[model samples]
Target chain A: MSNGYVFLSIAAMAVTTYLIRMLPMAIFRKKIENRWIKSFLYYVPYVVLSAMTFPAIFTSTGSVLGAASGCAVAIMLAYFDKGLLTVAIGAAAMAFIVQFAGM
Target chain B: MNLKEVKEGIKVGIPIALGYFAVSVAFGVSSVQSGVPFWGATLISLTNLTSAGQKAGVDVMAAGGSIFLIVLTTLIINMRYFLMGVSMSQKVEEKMPMWKRLLIAFGITDEIYAMSMSRSTHLTGSYMAGLIIPPIFGWTGGTLVGSVATGFMPSILAEAMGIALYGMFIAVIVPPSRRNGNVLLGVISAVILSVAFTYAPVLQIFSEWSVIIITVLVSAFMATFFPVKEGADNE
Candidate 1:
């Protein structure tokens, strides 16, 4: 891609993301009173994160076995309440091991 | 603007920054692999503090998609930030000025938002600035290193590291799901829906919009059936 294309795309993305994050914080001072709206907001992050992780994760490592091993280890570590670094490193390590073993 | 609060925020931000560094290194490498130049990838990280949104945007750009598509996909992928910003609007110190909020809002990532909201006291401009500063360096620095080093690193190690971001995502949601059934349901529903979108032939057409559609449907479903209890908004 040309420099201009990449630059323009980045600019557009940056502006779009900024507006989404900035609008509410800059404008809304009062508490959101609607139960459904509040609840939707509360759950949005988790659902988005979850949806993005799966299916995509399985293909991340180029090897299903390796990715699955890594994912399983990640889930196990995270379920035990491991910190983000620990869980992430653990998953990468597991994927490396599985890939190295060619299993 | 309190020094003490800024110091406290920096202290809390250390681990979060470290995590961002690891994940963003992977981001840098992958974006480069996807056809973005090293500097372009780093620039994206610098300009956009988000993880998933940046990834989605880069994917679109790498495919030669239009600027409009890039903005639209990023908007949908990042829609959750709107909600986070709303919650933050309520949580910020009562007297925080508009300019400070605007500047601080630029740095609101998922981790930053969660950390700020978890604080026992109302968020202060000084503390938020402190908390956000390190992660910016970590994210951008990691991208610089990763993108520049991609040519030298072995492919195996680079590919293995691909799982790091997902692992971090799992860390973010799994613990909460364990503590809250509503969260558990939301996650399960999202995973199932996402898989269906990926594998089901008929649903494959919507794969491009899967993240937005699935997020809205599942979040709304949970909100309607298992609305979070009042005053328990932190989760």
Candidate 2:
């Protein structure tokens, strides 16, 4: 990994990344006339997060038990409106302990 | 943009910052492990403000992947942010400066975007400041810690710490997943697709692409056909 090459790669990625985020807003400045499209956009986040998070939980150890322990604790905390940091650290701590005890 | 408002935004941003710190530390450690220098890790955390994009970029670089592959992977993984940015842009005052728009846009993660956009019409630059600073400190701090502690932590511990990212992610998902039947359907559908891509032959061609395209398309379609009755926007 040449320093120049890595720098250029990350820079390009950053530029493109920012552009991707900014472009849609610039284009759709006005309220979208399409209700269907609006509805779709509304629901996109829920699906996107699920798609991202589910595979992560299930695939971590090839067993849902470890993943479930973490997920259960996280869901409980989230239900109580705990902050993301608390939910994450608490569940991660539980998972760490469970995995440690197993070993 | 006043001092008081900025302080408020930062206050709201504290927990988000804390979450970002853990994730960014993982990112920094992984980047270093992949032969990326500490500066690169720090810079990436500072600039990218995206968990999936930075992580995927590092993985691609470590594997000596093509620029096209790296770009494609990140764009696909982060496409959802496009939607987020659009919605958030609406919440911002129309008279807001272009520079402010550009600067604040960099900080728009899922949580920040949700919290900020969900606000009423009373947003100010100070409010944005409050929203941005905590995560900035958390992320930068995490990278710094990871860069210094490189390799001191065991792989299992690191992997276990990674559960934090998943936990944060679950915190994000469970709310909407529980509320809307269609969102739940889209999630189940995407999971089945993801598993199929991993396990089923021939289907794997679309594995990486599946999450972005499936979620975007399915949720969009469902929203079009069956809108959430009590949408956050309507509230």
Candidate 3:
């Protein structure tokens, strides 16, 4: 793809992403009290995070073993109530070691 | 936005920014390696804070994908932002001006939305603004460094940083899930559905947007089958 195509793709993505994000804030004005909608909203964070993390995590670092090595450390540290930086960077470090070890 | 709220917002966002810097470094390397210029990568990160869409856009460009496909794929992959925005629309104080709300929407990533929403009190535009700044700079700055330093870093180090963002996502959810059974159930359900969606050949067609669909379905499932007491959110 040419440089123009790359810029064009970025523009397209930015506009679409911005509009999607803006629409919700632009439209919904009050607290949603409906049990179903409320519940759905409540769980959105966990659902989105888990959906994006799992399986995807196993492949994110270019190797399933490396990713899993990192993720296992992440879960343990996070379960022990580690800080975000510690758990996240620690996982990366562990993955780096695993990958460096030729895994 | 008061100075204090902005300070607190930056504080809450500091960890996110730290994580973003590490991850966007990977994004920088990937986009540049995929043939996107340094400035192009920087521009994408600045305008689109999305991790996947920005990275994937470069992938599409490298593969010679059509503009229509690029736009459509990003739209589908990023549809979750709409869900997040809708949810946040309710949480941010109704008194916040429309422009503030719109600007707040720009900073609504998975981590930001989760942190913003999970707070006990209503969000002000100032607070959200404070929250948004660090991650934006962290993301863009990392991309700039990564793209410029392409091939300068060892693959092992870069690979390690590659997974840090996912670890951040896990860190964000782990505490809440441990404290709240409803959250745990919702997470488990979403993970199960994600696995099913990934492996179930019939579900493969929705591959790109499966996360959005599964999230919506699992969230609704939690709401309907396992509603939690309202006070649970006060934490």
TM-score of chain B of each: 0.85, 0.78, 0.70
Q: Which stretches of model 3 miss by more than 4 angstroms?
A: A1-9, A20-27, B1-19, B30-40, B50-105, B108-134, B231-235
Q: Indicate the worst ten consecutive residues by lDDT in candidate 2 chain B.
A: B226-235
Residue lDDT tens for model 2, B1-235 = 4888887788789978887888777667657866889888888888778876676677568767667766776676666677777777778877787777777777777778878876776567679988887898899889878866766876656555656666776676666667767767876777776667567889766655655566667776687668755444631
Who wins the lDDT comparison?
1
My TM-score estimates for the predictions, one after another, are 0.90, 0.80, 0.74
Residue B161's C-alpha lDDT in candidate 1?
82
Question: How much is the lDDT of residue B215 in candidate 3?
Answer: 65
lDDT of each: 0.87, 0.71, 0.79
CAPRI quality of model 2: acceptable
CA-RMSD of model 2: 3.6
- Model 3 docking category: medium
Which pairs of residues collide in model 3?
A: none
DockQ versus reference, model 2: 0.48
Q: Candidate 2: where is the Cα deviation over 4 Å?
A: A1-9, A24-28, A58-68, A75-82, B29-38, B52-66, B83-94, B118-121, B147-150, B220-235
Please write out the lDDT profile of model 3 over residues A12-87, one tens digit for every residue.
9899989989987897544445666556666766777788787778877757898999999999899888977788
- Residue A100 Cα positional deviation in candidate 3, in Å, after optimal superposition: 1.4
